[model samples]
Target chain A: MIEKIFVGSKKYWFWVFSLMALVGIGLCFYLEQFQYGLGITGMSRDVSWGLYIGQFTFFVGVAASAVMVVLPYYLHNHKAFGRITILGEFLAIASVVVCLLFILVDLGQPARFLNIILYPSPNSVMFWDMIALNGYLFLNLLIGWTNLSAEYKGLSHPAWLKPFIYISIPWAISIHTVTAFIYAGLPGRHFWLTAIMAARFLASAFSSGPALLVLLALIMRRFSKFDPGKEAIFGLSKIITYAMIANVFFLGLELFTCFYSGIPAHCHSFEYLYGGGRLTMIMWLSALLACLSLILLINPKTRNNTGWLTLSCCSVFASLWIEKGFGLVVGGFIPNPLGKITEYWPSLPEVFIALGVWAIGLLILTGLYKIAAEVKSQESNAA
Target chain B: MNRRDFLKIAGVGMVSTIFEPVLPYEIKPSKKRLALLIDITKPFDIKACLDACNKAHNIPEIEDPKHKIKWIWPERFSDVFSEQIDMPKEITIPVLCNHCENPPCVRVCPTKATFKRKDGIVMMDYHRCIGCRFCMAACPYGARSFNWIDPKPFIKGSNPKFPTRTKGVVEKCNFCAERLDKRESPACVEPSNGSLIFGYLSEMKDLISNRYCLRRKPDLGTSPSVYYLI
Candidate 1:
């Protein structure tokens, strides 16, 4: 099974090498960031977290979305998802890798990261988040590898693997919930101190995760002998549609709560995001893209068509990436605790480090996917 | 016993032993809760207090406002009390860490790097901090500052007695715990011309009892130790 990744087409090797090259460039910039300090990044005392944290938040959602497929396929016995489940699990492994790397890059003292485990404070949401994310990563790796190995051997997956698969469903939900608690549990930062934050995170995660999965499945169809089945893709699009709708509705709820109540502390962050602040343009663009994607997804005619579906999926992924990834994290810090607005923009080194992390994730995804595709193709040829 | 069961029992025992010390100990009610009261009504040299704090802590003089490390500074009355519409805009108030009794920073630190002492003062262990900035995000008051770069180059003259922070750790006013340990008043308090009052909350009751002192965002329930005498 491991050998399958080594044997790939020239194009596959090119893709692998390109991602590696990006990882190399990113590593060089990261070294510079290490030598200097987090000062090299655009973050200030007012806005302490920036691109690194935002990316970490976004990828946590991506990683948790694996449960969307796992739940339906395993518990509900949705056979259509069986072919795509491995893809979801593999994507989760890659996304969690990215999430952990983002956290590492964002840390002021990367070497002291072990302190979180050494001097564990269960009172902190960060402590629980560390447990949830690492546990999920481990679960995905164990379950994914065991199942894939069994498949490659043309044997039924072990009976013992059943309990682990079931546990993964709730564990997936926990990862995103704990991540949301990191923000929602904070005393200040009105933008994040909402009870509904976890719900909103799950909604966006479900939408963005499935949207990316659909795009990857389409890419696999075009580039490889393995076909993930049209029914599986259709099922995922339907999930994306409902999740995006929920995500938009949750955003609307936040708007109504902030504006209708008319509290300055509560409304200032939204005012900065949608009104005259620096993020105004980007925020509006995300909203526009969300609406556009919804319009395309809601209609069955466009939803079924590959071209329109691809366009809508791209819109969904981009919209949530901006809304949840960039806007949400930065918006929380805009009106600093003292009613002062301090804007944040990532420096060049920060951007490269983030890009490098993404490349590492994609490289991992490429290798894992390459192995799964080979197994699926071999099974098909045998049949 | 089976190997699995034995392993589980061993794990539980080890975990309990590790966490036994971490469990909350009884805090003596008689222990002093140190507090500070800033009398805005009195005329104090704000610049002198700020200078004293910087020199005492060996805080860097970074030119970039974004990366500036400050333990204490003066802020406009209007900006600090934005909720108070009737407040005078021209008046400047000295602001620093409130040393909240129920510190959100202590709650959010993953490694227990920032913790609330039994005496109701929040403390930071610089060596243990992972620099996640969770404490900065959690704090209601913009008091905490991270060492964004190597501060040694920016310090005009280093204070040998005090530890100058390296880059990548969050730091803030320790309520001059070091000075308190030496039985000396805080650097800022000494130069504040009696404007900044420092004492136990119980002992300072006479000063705050008669005056209408306000705590920053008192409604948030952090129970800030710093009070403002208007």
Candidate 2:
């Protein structure tokens, strides 16, 4: 089976090489960033994190939310998700790698990261976040590989892997919740200070995570023989619907609490996210796209339509990305405590560093999936 | 439940109870407990505080204007609680480090460089820091400042009274530890014209009780050191 993978046609090779080239381009950009500090990016004294940290914050939820689909399918005795669960796990791996790399790029002293492990502070939410993320990453890798190998070998997986898989389900939720505490625990940053932040993070991550899986499932079907089937896509989309509506509801709840009472601290982050103030452009764009995507996604007819579903997912992904990634952290700092509006925009070099980190994720994903495909092919040939 | 099970449970319960007793007074320790000054009423000026601190510490002109090592800027207290707010809370309190019992900045620090002193002052050992600035992110006060460009030359030209910071390290109000070692008050503490109060924890509380309106960010739980006369 693995033999067929190496014996594959030129197109497979083309995709592989294209990924490498993009990675190369991203590396060149990373070098420039290293030569200069974050000043090269759009980050200002007020806004410390630009695209790098924003993307990191947003995608970590995507990575951690993988457990949502994995839990019921693997642990609760649902075999229906057998086909796509592998894909979702792999996506989790890809997202986790990207999240770590983004954190690396965002650090003022990337090399000093060993200090995080050596000097762990139990009281800090960030310490828990690091533990959870690294634990989840290895947990998925160990189990996903063993299970896939067992499938290829036509044997029952080792029982030990089952416990880790079960643990990962709840562990995934822990990763994102801990990340939210990194913000909510802060005293002055109004946008992230809300008690509802962790709940909101989970709600949004579930929807967007499943939405991303749905989009990938469709792409897999079109581009290759790997059609994960309509059942898988539909099942994932249903999950998306439930989670999306919950996300929107939580969002509404956040707005109502902030606006009706009109506490100025609570109001500012929303204002920056919605339609007014310095970040209005990003806020309005995200809101518009999110609303439009919800319209398409809510209708079962349109939701199931492959083209519209993909479009809707991408829109929602971008919208949520903008809201959490681009807008939240920067907006939280605007006018600052000094009542001064300090603006930040990402520079080209920083974008390149981000692009590079994302490329690395894609390359890793492609390689892992490629190996899976090869091994699966060999097993079928043997049969 | 049997006696053995009850004993096990009782032992565990006793252990947990011994760890943390939030009870009002379960034998308050005898160590000289230090507290930060939190003044809620009156305007704050950096200069008067610096001068008084200089006189008290016997380290006059400790801050070199050329180095500009310390900064004291007026901030809207309203913004402290809400980001969307553009105005102050009408009555602004002079603010500084709350010297949090469980400081978040210390938690997120990748390098373990930033630490809170036993006396309720958040201080930094710059030598140990690798300039990661993650502590800056962990700080909710927007209190920590980083030296983006090299600060060595800038500080060198000043009074040479204070050493300049290097590029990449995070720095903030030290609560004048140098002065504390000399048995003097912080530069920020000396200039208070009854508007600000600097004293031990119990004394400050007595002062706060006597004030017209004494309040703090009830939600933060950090219990600040600087006190105001409002």
Candidate 3:
């Protein structure tokens, strides 16, 4: 099965090498950051977390979103999703890898990364988050590989794998929930102290994760013999439609709560995000894209059209990426506890490091998907 | 490889595990809950106190505001007390670690690198810190600062006795715990000329009982050890 990835077309090798080049460049910048300290990044005393943390938060959602397809296929026995579930699990592996790397690059003392496990503090939310993330990654790898290998061998998956599959269902929810607790539990950050933060994270994740999957499935159809199935693609678009609506509705609820209460501390962050602050443009653009995508997705006529469906999926993915990846994490720090506004913009090294991480994820996805496609093609040819 | 050898090792391990908790270790219970009282009404020399803290802690003098590390500094009154509706006369107020009883930083630290000591001071183990910056986010008062760069070059004159921090660790004031252990006054308190008072909270109650004192964001339930006499 592993040999399938190595024996690829010329185009595949070119793509693989391109990603390797990016990983190499990112490693060079990371070494510089390691020597100098986190000062190479745009983070300041006020906004201590910047691009790395924001990316970590966003990718956690992508990793957790694998549950959507897994639940329908395994629990409900939805036959259409059987072909696509492997793709979700594979995407999760790639996303979780990206997430862990972002955390590593963001650390000031990357060498001491083991200290979190060495002297574990159960009282801390971060301790639980570390456990949840690593556990989810292991679960996905075990479940995805076992199922894929069994399918390739033309045998039924082992019955013993049932419990792990069920456990992964709830475990996926826990990963995103713990990630939300990291920000939601804080006392002074008015913007992130909302009770609905976990719900918001789940909604955005459900929408965005599958939206990216739809794009990936379409890409696979173009380049490989694996057609993740038309029914499965449409099923995912339906999930994205409702989830994006819920995400937008949650944003509205936050707005009403902040303005109706008329509390300055509660209102200040919104003001920073929507009211003439540095993030105002980006925030508005995200809102616009969300609305645009929702309009396109809700209409059955447009959704049935592959071109419009692709457009809306791209919109959903981009909108949520900006809102969660850029706005939510950074907005929480604005108007710091002292009522001082210090904006953060990622440095060149920081952007390249992030891109490098994304490239690594893509490379992993390419290999895993290549194997999946080869097995599917072989099975179809025999049939 | 033999049964006797395995039995010997198991017995020793079992004995050590059983007795380790009961060992007669020197556990020093703190006799005082220390507090700092600042008399805002008095003319305070902010620069002198800042200078003393910088020299005492071996803090660097980095020109870049983004990467600057500070243990103690002065903030404007309006900014510090932004929740106040009526605008008071603007003045400089010294701010540092509150050493809160219910410290959010300690609760959020994954590695227990930042912890509250027995004497009500929040201590940071620089060596143990993974430089995650989670403490910086959890601290409501902006009390924590991260070593964004190697601080050695920026130190005008490094204090040999105090350890200079490496890049990527979080640090803040420990209420001069080292000085307290030596029975000497904090470097900042000594030069404050009665403007800053450092003593056990119980002993200083009489001094603050009659005056109108305030603690930063008391509503947050952090129970700050620092008090300002307005």
Report the number of the highest-DockQ candidate. Answer: 1
lDDT of 3 by residue, A183-228 (tens): 9998888899999999999999999999999999999999999888
True contacts kept of each: 0.80, 0.24, 0.80
Task: Report the CA-based lDDT of candidate 1 relative to the real structure.
Answer: 0.92
What tens digits encode model 1's per-residue C-alpha lDDT throughout A190-235?
8999999999999999999999999999999999999999999999
Model 1 alpha-carbon miss at residue A329, Å: 0.5
- The pairs that clash in candidate 3 are none
lDDT of 2 by residue, A1-383 (tens): 33444555688789767878878888887666565544456765456556887788788888877787787788676676876787878889999999988888776556677766666555556667788889888987887788788887788689888788888888888888888887787776777778988888898898888888888777766665565778778777777777777888888887888899898767866665555575788778887887878888789999888888888889878888888888877777764544556666777777777878888988777766666655554555676
Please report the candidate that would top lDDT against the real structure.
1
Model 2 ranges with Cα > 4 A deviation: A1-14, A377-383, B1-70, B75-96, B100-102, B107-111, B127-134, B137-140, B153-164, B183-219
- Stretch of 10 with least lDDT, candidate 1 chain A: A117-126
Better of 1 and 3 by DockQ: 1
Please provide, for model 2 over B1-230, each residue's C-alpha lDDT reduced to its tens digit, 9 standing for 90 to 100.
99999999999999888644222111223234455554554555645765554333223122422112334434556645443233444544444455556566765664557776656667776656655566666565656666544554333224344445554566777767776778876666566664455556765666657764333354556545554344
lDDT of 3 by residue, B93-113 (tens): 899999887888988898888
The list of candidate 1 runs beyond 4 A from truth reads: B1-17, B24-30
Model 2, residue A260: distance off in Å is 1.7
DockQ of each: 0.66, 0.21, 0.49
Better of 2 and 3 by DockQ: 3
